[model samples]
Target chain A: MSDSLFENLRLELRRGCLTLAVLANLRTERYGYTLRKALEEAGLEMDEGTLYPLLRRLEGQGLLASEWREENKRRKRFYRLTPDGERMFDHLAAELQRINASLERIIAEAHA
Target chain B: MTTLFERYLHAVGEALPKDVVAADVTAEIADDLHSRAEEREAELGRELTDEEAAAILREYGDPRVVAARYGRVQSLIGPELLPYYWSTLTLALVVVVALELVVGGISAIVRADGLRFFSALDVAVHSLVWVFTIVTVIFAAAERVPQGRQRLARVMRWDPRALAAPSALPPVARSSSLAEFIANTLALLVLLDARGAHRVPLDRLVATMLSDLHLTLTVAWQPALVGTAVGAALVAIAAMIAFLRPQAAVVHEMLRMLGSVVAIVGLAMTLASGPLFDPGGGIATTIGYVTLGAAIAVLAVQAVLSVRALLVRAPMPTPKSARG
Candidate 1:
């Protein structure tokens, strides 16, 4: 009914997906801008501001590893999934798939 | 001129925590901004304006909010300590108000002096500010304290059983509950007894209290006296409502406000009598002083309960969901 309410619900729904996407994409080491561009190319557009902080937080939680490395004469922080992060990403992806399957079944039954 | 890119980088760095590597972070941001500006220029086939660069920075949102996303949750008073903070602050402030009133009342009675409005107000304001500041500082420090140390005592353990317990008693309605009916009836009886309307006669009650005091009980005294009676009547009505509809939240809040008004009126009546001391020390003066003390005590309890009521949220019954 309200635009603000819709935006809030959208934000909440995106929060879980964002974490999963970030983890999955960080399997290969990439700097902040490149990771964001990769995600955007795959249809999940993320703000640079939101993604950078998230990378830092995931690194802090020990799920992602990062280091400052110079590339093309400019230094940038590169992030990639750790072994722990890979395991976490697999677990989360499985859980999300289960939830989506239940929703699909319910929708199909309702339509029938 | 400091380039727009440098200024934006500076703003972001300023909001970041001190522990963050400022130089590395700013350098990364500067490169990212350069790429973004180049993209915009390529699309337009021209270099970006200062205003356009400023727009990009604004689009990133408040630097503080952006920076906060990189840190742990920030709050002046964290959720865990909020309830305790309010309780300590409310209790301290209520006690301070009571002590001020008692001291003022007793001083006036002993001196046989009239209670001046401005001076009494001055004392109340000063005491309130002092109590508020001290309580806030202590609780704020508790909230800011890092983990790994016990801020509260060991007695405040996290027990699952506490979750199932009802934190506060429901509000009293006049008709639905027996206990509420009795409580309200008893309070009314106390009001009548204080007036001596049910027993020793009104004049004797008036004469006994008034003769020792240096007050010319005029038509002005009538308002507060009448107000006490009216407040008592409202309390009786509130009790009846409780007896009828114990579930009505709004009505109970209204009754509580009425009760507060009544207590305030009663206090006004005591002040209107001037100093409570009987010039001639006798049985009448002793009775008068005790009665004054009891009245002040009742007002203090009401004030504290009102503060409690304000703090606690009354849960309303939920309506049925559309899905059902």
Candidate 2:
């Protein structure tokens, strides 16, 4: 039961972080394959099932943009952050830092 | 010559909603899967086997689940109002059952035939389905409206002061029991109305109804009707027995549940035989479809509830000393 509880909480925590991570990674124009590989290398592995749908939702929300192009005689769809996405990414990044600092202070005070 | 990759993509596309940009999604996924496979091939310095390729698809997830994620199927009935939805449904079902039984009992006494009561039951079953559907639709719509959701959530939230005091179970009313017994006895006689038996007056009522609705049943319907009659007879017998011996409550419930299963099978056979109404296009046909659908749904719910009662152990009488 505790393991299940932790898993539920872990998913809840990861849900928001994932959106931010995807936005951060997509600041550079990268296809689904390369973007996933980059994030995995950065220790933020995500399932293809999850990553692709997230990309679609972000695109639908106008936070990201995509287009199809050919490379090495194969068709691929590449995605990048839009202007609004870039702005939102900056705002969220700042919010994360503020939250981290507050958490650190609280932990230090408790220890002291 | 469809490759495993193409077959996987096809399966995903099949699961997606028709309105979605399935082509674009499939194309993107196709490219990504191919890229990954190619990368692996490059590392191994050889073409991958079909089993190896299938392993990757397996890791991806079930096609339908993946498609559903893309659809982002939000809950129609949100978590906040779920408890209220269930409570309301249970209340509605109880009221419907009580009202139907009482009406059926009264109708049987007046008409001097049990089929009259069963006719009332037929209407009750159909109405129950409509009630269920409307309630669900209303709650689902309410969930979409923020203000409505908040109001409903507030209303549903329990207060300490509002809690009812603990009370003992009420005694059974003998009058209601007698009424049910009479109704069941009448129903049995009417259902058993076959060759060399007194013809029930219900045939004329049924004929008039069919004529009004512009329906003409084929000879095939006779067997189905007979099957349902047999099932209803079983239920009636069970009810009459229960009324006489209250201690046989568990047996009564089980028998009733069994009767319902038989009745459901009979109803299904009726549907499988083909259209009950003659070939036509009008409001009557529409009504017929809705009535059939609702009746089936109502019976299915009845069967499920019976099973649930048995699972939870139906209320058995205990001696006063044992009650302590």
Candidate 3:
């Protein structure tokens, strides 16, 4: 039960971070497979189901733009951050840094 | 032969919500899956086997779950419209059942065949199924229109003061009058076209049915044409009156009764002339008889209702000062 609880909490924690990572990585136009590979290289491994749907939702929210184009003799849908998406990413990234700094400070004080 | 990969994509596509763009999503997923397989093949230095592809698909998650992530499965009829849906369904079902019973009963009595009741039961069940599907689809579609609920609410709003006494002539609804007018006009056109030199689609259909039955309706045309024309004309007159006056229930009902009687007499006269089709037996004959019987039964019911309406005493007109 404890293990399952930890796993659930871990997933909840990763969810927002993964979305943030996706937005950050999409600074360059990339298709699904390439994007996943990029995120994996950045130490954020996401399931296909989770990643694709998240991309779709972000696009639906007008934060991401996608278009089908030919690459390597095959059609692939490429996604990138829209202007609004760029602003949102910048805002969220700053917020994350502030939160991280506060968390580190609290942790160091507790340890002392 | 569909590959396991293709089948998996298809399954996912099937599980997606109606509103979702399944084709585009499935295509993207397919590309990703193919990429995964290619990477695995590169690692192993060979093409991946079916089992390896299956493993990849299995790792993704259940098709339904994967689809659920993309879009929610919304209710066809939402909670807001559910009560109205139920009420409409109930009313439609009651009308269908009543119609089936009456028509079936009359057909059985006329043919002296008790089995007609069974056929009627069969027809009733079929009609109920159709009615349920139609009503559900209509309501489901209606739910999608944001303004539909508001429109329906507005239509259903009632005024206590507008309620007339039992003796008062019920106000004629222009919409209903317009509908009646259109129905009568279209019917008259079909009848005239069928009788005259010009052959319409309805005429062609009748010709096909008659040909299939090895029957000729040349003898029956006169009575059928006469009946339909006279009946439709009377109904058209009633519709015009209703449209013009909007407070002539008595006149409308009387005309409607006269129309029903004219149509019934025409049908009865044709029926009295003997069998409509050449000697034949089986399901076709049963269908033909049931159709005729149902038509007569419907008209008879309409006539009875019209008579009842005529019998009701009109309410006394209120003085203009009292109206306030």
Candidate 4:
């Protein structure tokens, strides 16, 4: 009901989904700003400030593989999802779809 | 001019760990800033000024706020330990206050000098400061230990079966009207004979010891004490009658009258009683105005109950829809 409380709860709900989204997009090589822009295109507005830190955390967790190479006359660390990340993503995607379908059914039954 | 881009990177670098890794981290951020500035210039079809770069950096937020995301989470005491911290502080404060009261009471009784107000207060303050400081330091240190949060969290884990079944509980009584009857009666007896305690008085021994400590009040209000006691008695009687004869309008008026007497007794006590001779000898106005303040609080609550009892005779407000 309160705006800040609603924001905090919404942030918590989105935390896991953001991680999954980030890992999924890393299936192809992309750098910090590019990954952020890609996520924005998918309708998730991530803070550019947080994007690099999240990238570092995911790489540290072994869910992402990264390397630096020169592009457009500047060097940038590019990231891609690891094999382990791919398997984790498939499992989470299945779980999310199952939950979504169940929730839709519940809403429909309530309306009926 | 130290450009805003340079200033921003310096701040980020300072927040980061002071090691070789810091260099690489700063380099990454500097590269990101340059790329963003170039993109903005391209969009505007011109080179951006230092102020424009500053605005972009400000939108990114404070360096420390952004850097905090990269650091391992740190707190002196986090939410997981907060409940235990509160319980410990509360328990410690209660025990310390109680110990000071007992020790000060004994010292005043033994010393012909009687209880000095400041001495007892000094002990209480010292005890609280020492105990509170020690407990906080211990918890803060414990919070720094590796895996400490997880270890503490595991200790408070919930089990589904541990909670009591709501349906299994015995039903509450329909009303609790007579709950204060016994308490009021005891207070009345104490008020009736403030001097009577000095007769057989183990309490009088304590009182004599207490009085011996030079902790006596400047003026005694014996009549006001008696009035408060009598008011308490009348209030108890009124409450009992109101409950037993809830439908009787006459009885409700009597309860209201009794509530007024209790309030007047409080006013009289406040007028007649003087300041305690030794303010720190713990609850200094033994048989007088100190009791009056407590009696005033009790009267206020009793007054509310009396008002409610009087209103019972009046018809309840009904919705217009119900009438229709």
Order of quality (TM-score): 1, 4, 2, 3
Query: Per-residue alpha-carbon lDDT of model 1 for B82-161, expressed as tens digits?
Result: 77767677667655654554454334323433232225447978988998888777766765566511556333556764
C-alpha TM-scores of all predictions: 0.62, 0.56, 0.44, 0.59
Report lDDT (CA) for all predictions.
0.66, 0.74, 0.79, 0.65
Candidate 3 residue runs with Cα over 4 Å from true position: B73-324
Write the candidate numbers in order of decreasing lDDT. 3, 2, 1, 4
- Scoring each candidate complex against the real one, what DockQ results? 0.61, 0.62, 0.58, 0.51
- What TM-score does candidate 4 reach? 0.59
lDDT digits (tens) for residues B4-78 of candidate 4: 778787888788744326666666777777777888889999988778888789887899876666765556687
Please tell me which predicted candidate would have the highest TM-score against the true structure.
1
Error of 3 at B278 (Å): 82
Docking class of 4: medium
Model 3, span B1-324: residue lDDT tens: 128888888999999978789999999998888888888889999988778888888898898888888764256787877877776886687567656744664454345454554587689889989999999998877766768766765665768879756645577899999899889856755665554333467778877777786766545435655675668767866786677667767778888899899888887777666555565456655675677668789999999988887777865777899877
- Report residue B314 deviation for candidate 2 (angstroms): 32
Q: Give lDDT for model 3.
A: 0.79
Candidate 1 CAPRI grade = medium
What is the TM-score of each candidate's chain B when compared with the real chain B?
0.49, 0.45, 0.44, 0.46
Q: What is the TM-score of chain A in candidate 1?
A: 0.92
What lDDT would candidate 1 get against the real structure? 0.66
Clashes of each: 13, 0, 3, 4
Task: Give the per-residue lDDT digits (tens) of candidate 3, residues A1-97.
Answer: 6999999999999989999999999989999999999989988999888899899989989999999998877789999999999999999999999
